[model samples]
Target: MKLPPWFRRRRVGVAATLVSVAALTAVMAPLQDDIGLLNEGLLLLLLTLVISGTWGREVGIFAAVTSNLALNFFFVEPLHTLTVQSPENVLALFVFLGVSIIGSSLLAAARASAEEARRREAETQVLLSLSRAMIGQTEPAEALASLCREVVAAFDAPGASVLTAAAGGWGVLAHAGSADAGRPADAQERTMAEQAASSGQITRIGHTGLGNSRRPRIVAPSGTQRIREADVGSAFVPLLFGDRTLGVLRLDGPIGATPFAQHPDSLLAAFAGEAALGVQRAELAQAASHADALRQADEMKTALMTSISHDLKTPLAGIKTAVSSLIDTSVEWSDEDREAFLATIDSQADRLNRVISDILDLNRIESGVIAPARRSVHVASLLDDVRERTALVTKPRVVTLDAGADIYAQADETLMAQALVNLIENAAKYSAAGAPIHLAASAAGASVEIVVSDEGPGIAARDLPHVFERFYRAQEGSRRVKGSGLGLAIVKGFVTLSGGSVRVESAPSGTRFVIQLPVAEQAKASA
Candidate 1:
């Protein structure tokens, strides 16, 4: 981080003062300047080394040898002579000189390495926080905005920029700092951003004469260069997902820094991966949102159709009954022929009624006119209840229950049972007679799961995601089923509202529909 210029000066001044004092003391200290008394000056040099090494290695070395010379010249018995006056002084002086030189340099290097490590650690933490914040963000604009602001705060930079590819060119989706950072991008910069987006290469430049092949053509404010050589010692890190360049993270160094330390790129690479994930998540969320809206509209259309069927079927049933009565004409018609005509009319009218009822119930649940009332319900009991209701169809299918009989969850008993019925009926309607449907339940940490597995040609992979969507019939649009396609949607709504979730897993072997509902807490008052 860049501090105010005054603060930096204060720090430098303090260090220099300490170094100067250490040097002065080493030179002036009293030393018996004789060949045998060389130890005194050498000891002074060692003191200077430990205290002054980090300030400057050269200063430490200079102070040590210079003090020895001063001691020999002034304190030696033969005054003003170059001789140490004792051979011992010569050996001690040589040892002190070597120690000062090697010790200070090593010490300085170690200190620099430690400080650098600390800076790198801090930067990593900031980048990690940014990545975490961006997760689960599905909107590109919001994701970009978050990325820009985070990097700005992390690096303490003057500004930050996020450039993304767009129609026919590049675009600045978000920015933080000066130059109307968040406003529309300049035309030329937008073009360059697009190119960088395509190449997926980092483009860094200072506010000097240099730029990458496709330079930043935008101008800065008057009197201050648009790309100031110092502040704009720029870095352009491309956000990539394999061959695709999702965006670019552009940062300007702190104001007045002379070539800031080169920030590591591995951390930057990790950040890019996180950003790409954010973009992907945002896109998925957006698509899901649209799909939801369309699904509601489709459900409404199905309800309209169901209502029409009901309105049309009621009168048709009366007409068919009257026609059957007239065909008999007080026992004039053949019994077999009359029976066949009446059966056909009854079957078709029943189909119409089922469709209408399904539509009405779906609309009620989904539109919130009738909300599911959730309570602690036993899973096995719910299944048995549905089985009884669906017995007429399940008798031939040999429906079986294989699950924890004691399992329970907080859910609407009626709605949950209805969901089970739909699943069983769905199996019966699609699968051949005598093909069994298996109902199972188990506890998994926070949730109690119920799975309904059936031996039927499972849903296709492409269609799996759309199964819960309304009117998403695997059958073609024009085909008719005695259903409104609203049951699964209602099931989903009820399950979700009750703090539960559902997923459809299928394979060539069969289809397994899983429902995960939160377990009811055992408490004295809250339960």
Candidate 2:
């Protein structure tokens, strides 16, 4: 139970007066003979000043009255009586009382000022700490929860909870302290939260009649009526950000136990404002992250469409032109001319097939569906297969293969041959006309290294890193080379699936592609 304000004030004043009088009495008794009336009066006045500086005006006034009465009864000429012996004693007693009252009043004002300054300092520190804690948080829900815990601790409330307005109703974002003690247990308490959030004002339940105002009664669609302050016991502070009310901060404690209810509404509002800004910052950060991801995906989609369109159009145009020339009877083509045109049609059709196959292979590899079937194969045999398949397109360019006898690699032969074909074709397109393209294999420790070196204009330093990426082509000298840009990407995919590695070295002299495949243990032992 809380005591009435007037009663509590009187009790504190009476207690301070009694203690001050007792201390003066105890000190005056031992020195009464040695200390004259003037010394005794000064001692009692000093005691009153000290008491007044520690307590406030009400207690200070009481101490002055007690000290004046005690001075006359114990230290005046008529000892142990409230009577003065002469005019001089009367003058001395009056002077002592007047000085005591003025000194106590001055000291009391100074004490109240000091107390106020200390209180403001404490409030500022709490606000600073709360701001620091909220600023470092990047998630909305987590930041709100941390804010609630800080508020509860700062205000020394029994319990506190933060509620956010949602589609269904008020949702609890975070709670601190006992669940039963801090949260709304009845519909009336929840109504208070809704009222505060909707009105953007501080709402209180079970408050003393100070600053009480009636709000319009709220009625739910189900016919539930809002309860007045007499029926509930809590305080609700709305968190407002700009023009929007974000939520309500609910505080629960015994009647008159919640410090926030007693504090100025502006202070609580300031705290709510900080929390609202923190939540808004976190929400904006999350939205930016999501938007960035969507932008990257859209860019990838656009690039894929553009690359596929160009790759398909080039081969389709060639095939169409060759077919048109062959079927035109009006032209009266000779046998040799017809044979050359037929070969053009066949080669263009084959190029189209290869383009389609590369697209499918790249998709399969990226989706992790291309599982290689490993086997032991001779390096020389693999090189021959690649040379034969690529000879049709890479004519006039000499392809050489150098490998030791009986040297075998453990890999998927079909995938390995495809990888080699891509490397040889790439080398032929970029190298000098009629330049020799070298395909050499050597045993290095436990692996077989296949090196494809070309006497072509080497790739630029900047484009080397991204050469293995899908749809990436060397921009410096690749304008004349016709390709779908999936050749090296496919080679890298196949080599990786076979448990091998591929890398390239380029300079002004030449470009070298080194592929390392694990050698069969038996073959390595024999070598």
Candidate 3:
């Protein structure tokens, strides 16, 4: 609880000094003769210094005058009288009074200086805390709310709030304490806040016993620059960055409580500056994030257009040419020639279908719409299915499967087959015409490893890590590897959807793609 201002005034100090002096004289009067007049004056001077240190300068001065009179009466040659008989005693009395007054003033000034240092230290700590909060929180609303709480706690105010200028008018960005505490209690208080924001100055209002005054009363103290003081209550600090005024910080203290008044005006303004900087930084970060998203979207569109113009059109051109050859009337085509043309049409159509499927599958995977239905899948059967589906493409290249009969995995059979087909086809496209593709499956502790390896020229080390990225090509331009580049990305997505992981190892001799799936029995045991 805060004491009334009168309780803290000089009257209380004067009464305390009187009581203290009376007590000292009662104890020291008997020893005055043995201690001598000089000793008595020293003891009285000590008493005056103690009173001054405890009750401040005004009370100390009063104590000094009272002590001088008491020493002349109770301990000087003319005991119990205000008159000092000897010239030496008169000199001693004057010296004692002068020293006590001077000592009290020095002691009081020292105490005030120490108090001001402590207050400044506290203000620095609050500013440091605000800086940390601003840097730590990325969201503007959350950071401002945290700062409001800190302000309310630091000042012991009823509440605090931050208001930002909005389209139509001011909007409360964040507030702490009671719902009504930080908010303007009336139009007059709101106008004061707006005045501070518009003028780029600190505005304070103190409540009189009758009510708040109609106009704000301003005062400047000796030690501070442009420090404004009122009776005691609310303060409105503007948040200014450069020439722009971002918002206002409203501090609401109770009437007769000098929470905001206890700190210097410069410290409050520093807090406002910190809040403005946080607002500007948050806005910049948000703008950067938005720009990044737009750039990614543009890149995706460009890559998709590139793929359509090359991979899709290549097969389409072959199909159209083969159809035109089969229907040509001028030439007498042989039975074998007709059959070859039909085969070309079929192969090109299959290739076109694969490219479209990869595009759609990639879209689904990226959209998080694909959910795998995992179950026990026989390793040998899965490989056999993949081999049959990819036979048309992997024609001249040989595919050899190596797997144990007992090996089984927990996976979605359809997704697993599709992923394997992509890998096998990818290997066939890159390897030598007659090169052998190896498919191997083995039990490795609680998991099963399925590896599709090719004896083709290994991928460049720079391209190895990005092999699973959609639309990435190791070689750019006309000489680049064929296909949409979505095959390996689909392989990784499908495997991961089935609760499995895929990785690759490449060297000068060859490239190997490994997929690890949980063993059927092990998955069941854990579940």
Best by lDDT: 3
Least well predicted 10-residue stretch by lDDT in candidate 3: 207-216
Alpha-carbon TM-score of each model against the true structure: 0.43, 0.62, 0.60
Query: What tens digits encode model 3's per-residue C-alpha lDDT throughout 1-527?
Result: 34465655678878877887788888888877788878777888998888787668888899999999888888887788888799988998899999999999999898768767876787878878877776768687788888887777666667778877656566777888768764644554566667787777776766322113332343332344554344545767789988988888877765223333444465667778877876676567778889999999999899889976788899989989989988998899999999998999999998899799889999999999988899888898789889888898888788999999888899998888989999998898778889999999999899999999999887888899999998887863224557888999999999999889999999878889999999986345246
Ten-residue stretch with the least lDDT total in model 1: 208-217
- Cα RMSD for candidate 3? 10.5
lDDT scores in order = 0.65, 0.76, 0.79
lDDT (tens digit, per residue) of candidate 1 on 1-527: 44443433435534654555455545554434343345555555566565444444555555556655655665544557778767776776577667766776777677657656876777768777886767766577677668777766665567777666655545666777777554455553453355456556555555422222343333343354354345345556677877877777666654332222333455556656766665566557768889999998888678666646655676577657757675666767677866766776776667667666776776676677766687787777787788889998777778888767667788877778878888778777656577888888887777899998888777778878988876666654223334556667767876776668888998867889899998765441145
Cα lDDT of model 3 overall? Answer: 0.79
Q: How much is the lDDT of residue 458 in candidate 3?
A: 78
Question: Model 1: runs farther than 4 Å from truth?
Answer: 1-175, 178-332, 475-482, 521-527
**Would you list the clashing residue pairs of candidate 1?**
35-85, 35-86, 35-89, 138-282, 207-229, 220-226
Model 3, position 344, has a per-residue lDDT of: 91
Residue-wise lDDT of candidate 2 within 248-344, one digit each (tens)? 7776544333333334455566678876775566557768889999998898778878888888888788878878888888898999988988888
Ranking by lDDT: 3, 2, 1
Per-residue lDDT for 44 in model 1?
Answer: 59
